[model samples]
Target: MFFKLQSLALIFLGFNAYASPLAEPNEVHISERGAGLNSFLNLLLSYLPAIDTSVTDATGIITDFDNLLGALTGAQETYNELGRSCTEWTVIFARGTAEPGNVGVLVGPPLFDALDDKFGSSAITIQGVNDYSASVQGYLAGGDSNGSAEMARQIRAAKSQCPHTKLIASGYSQGCQIVHKAIAQLDSATASWISSVLLFGDPLKGQALNSVPSSRVFTACHALDDICKNGILIGPSHLTYAVDVVNAVNFAAAH
Candidate 1:
């Protein structure tokens, strides 16, 4: 009886340890790295409207914001159609900081091409998020809740609506921060359903290093990428991830 009781106690202790939140990884300190003049400028830019309201149409009147709303709605409809057809795997991609409406240029074309080459076009589905400011301000000031919540919702929907399909979540730069936040909030079962997570030039790399098992998470940061440097000056390397996408896809395939 004592032996059986000891075994049960050990199992309970093990489960509790596994379920606890992990200690933060040792990395460059955000406070020391993320502060300074450049960081300030980046935050300021996030507050300014990306579009100029002063631009007028041929009728000499400013275009209504409703036009932008309509375009976004149309895009969502198109994405919904694609999502409905996804059979094998779904890749939810989040764009980098301050690059709204540019995920196609930044990571989509090459990443999707690689996936199609490996699994065929119809075997994969692509969903991209670019509406958020994804700026330094959003990351530092906790304004990423909306973006993280949207990401979490999509993940949950994919799991419930497509039970057999695999899920791969990829993000770049500040987008990586959002993905990390979303993943951290997921229930263990839903988190386990994610086959892989790929991050490129991740600014929040330190904070997220232990969120998942190292085997399921892959990260690539350029040696010169200042954004991933945890508060260093922004550099040209931050703008490129073509090679990383290919590598990430390869990792996903193998896993």
Candidate 2:
């Protein structure tokens, strides 16, 4: 169901509960990855000030919310496109990550460490340059010029590696901002090449995307997770994005 901003305040506080102990990363990459996405989305949904009951269906609720956000930002077309893409790509990536089932979490530091360990074995190629520091704040914090540029470079390179394949850029928390900035930087022609962007914990101001089309960006945030509650800047505002099936099921059960 669609939630009103006002009603969100009541259930929003519940998100802080999950912020407690860090859940052990799943040995299986698909599960761990999906957990990471849920963790972040829980945080997003909790921040909502209201819930719209008119959206009785799960997918409809998300679409209605996206439409609401799109109306506010005057980007309905983009938001609609992105909403569809996120749903489609979730299955594609989840399946791909499941095969190895050892890809590791997508969070910073710990996740990156695990990824490094995986890469050492040469299981996955070093698709992007390691030039940008994977710091929690500095460049990796997202939105920094260097970090965003580095991400663009990675996408361009990855695109070249598999020219025929669709490219999906998935990120968590601050990483989401970096991905968004990179996508924003792309020219209309180049941006179209992206198959999808799955943002696990998008915290950037969706309003900031006024210049770009929303259809290319797909954001997923936790309803009771608080990792991305506070932005690097300031203010008590929380970020919100569309949720995926794995997360939708989790939230439904929680409610």
Candidate 3:
């Protein structure tokens, strides 16, 4: 029992290892995780290859084990709501540093599920910021230039193509830095399309979101979340932001 808890603790605690800040991120690091835990994560993800997010069932809530794992592992990584008959809202998300997949496993999936459950799948589109690597060096350097540019391009494309969807830009950890940089790249016209901005464990917490109004933005920095103060701790507090999803979602929906 202790082993299980310790294993999870290690996974979160291993994040923000300053010693190897420049190494490329791989599943938070393929070698850093034990073989047993790796196998367990793989098996857990295999049962539900597609998160089926953005299309909630009659129950309208994610309750299954595999389904919940889907949210944790970023199974909704493929959810892109563009090119559909209608898109009332569009969410462009950047995952944390070292997290696997474009959306990352930690925060992206749960956010997708919450938006889906609240707004209904048909009303929203969630797109992962695939253009960025979410690299460690990028986090240490404030933000990756290329990643920031790519995210801005995506935000512009989403709003330009749909022309009607309310845009939401979101990020976690290093992803938050990219969000900050990306927003800076936007012109006044493109910036106005952003209906809401969500930042979790933001490294640039106090810094304003260039053109986005404070009333339309929601930032969550849990107690002891060193990242909020520009520290890269990635502590247990950082992992607990999932608990704030309901409030964050409500905040987003309001805008």
Candidate 4:
């Protein structure tokens, strides 16, 4: 009986010694990144009104926003098994409207009515793809043309927090265009760290990405995605953004 009690005590001590918290320093770093990414959703909630007002016309925007939150937030769980993770950092490229007034889309439909009347039922075509980028530049850099430069600085900040970590930019429609410009302006050192870019229903002028590295660029187009292809004429039409990311992740894991 004395020997058995001693053995049980040893086992308990061993378990306590091995027990560690689920989150490590790297995990905390990645969590911060995820928080930054979620800030974009907050930006959307704050700025959706004064910029386009067209957001009110599309019900899909809300749905897509929810889906994006799920995908990004869930990325940690999905990547846990692989030991590869992300530190998501998302921010508003621009700011148009003030908060308080922009809050509550369902608070009686006054704002919704304004948006529907302005944008109408037809899908709004993205003509000036650079407009939002320009706005973002103004917001971040206090000027236009310097938006990409600002983005490079932001990437550097992220790198400082998480050294040699992979960066992925995923955007839909017009958002993709803004991300593309940000990628273009990135310095070579920063560019090398990019893992993949996932573009959904890209509508921006294809020429914006001309100088960007071809190997890293991928476009995901829906069959009926007339929205992105409307006015754009030429550019890389092959390879999809979503499939490329999945394949790239798998390849990296396997290797």
lDDT of each: 0.57, 0.38, 0.66, 0.34
Model 1: what TM-score?
0.64
Candidate 2 clash total? Answer: 29
TM-scores for all predictions: 0.64, 0.42, 0.71, 0.38
- For model 4, state the Cα shift of residue 157 in Å: 1.6
What is the Cα-based TM-score of model 2?
Answer: 0.42
For model 3, the run of ten residues with the poorest summed lDDT: 53-62
Residue 21 of candidate 1: its Cα lDDT?
20
List candidate 2 segments past 4 Å from native: 1-129, 139-142, 205-216, 224-255
For model 4, where is the 10-residue window of minimal lDDT? 95-104
Q: Give the per-residue lDDT of model 2 (tens digit) for 73-166.
A: 2221211111121121211111001011111122222222233333331222223213333343442334455656766765665555545544
Show model 3 residue runs off by greater than 4 Å: 1-74, 83-85
Candidate 1: 10-residue stretch with minimal lDDT: 54-63
Q: Candidate 3 residues 1-255, lDDT tens each?
A: 123556545543442131122121221222322333344334433332222222112111212332334433436444555555548888888887766567765577667767776787778877777767666677888988887997898898887788888888999888899999999999978886799998888988878887788888899887566778887444445544554555678898898
Q: Tell me model 2's lDDT, rounded to 2 decimals.
A: 0.38
Cα displacement (Å) at residue 15, model 3: 14
**Which of candidates 2 and 3 is the stronger one according to lDDT?**
3
| RMSD (CA, Å), each prediction | 21.3, 16.9, 12.7, 20.6
Error of 4 at 24 (Å): 44
Name the lDDT value of residue 199 in candidate 2: 57
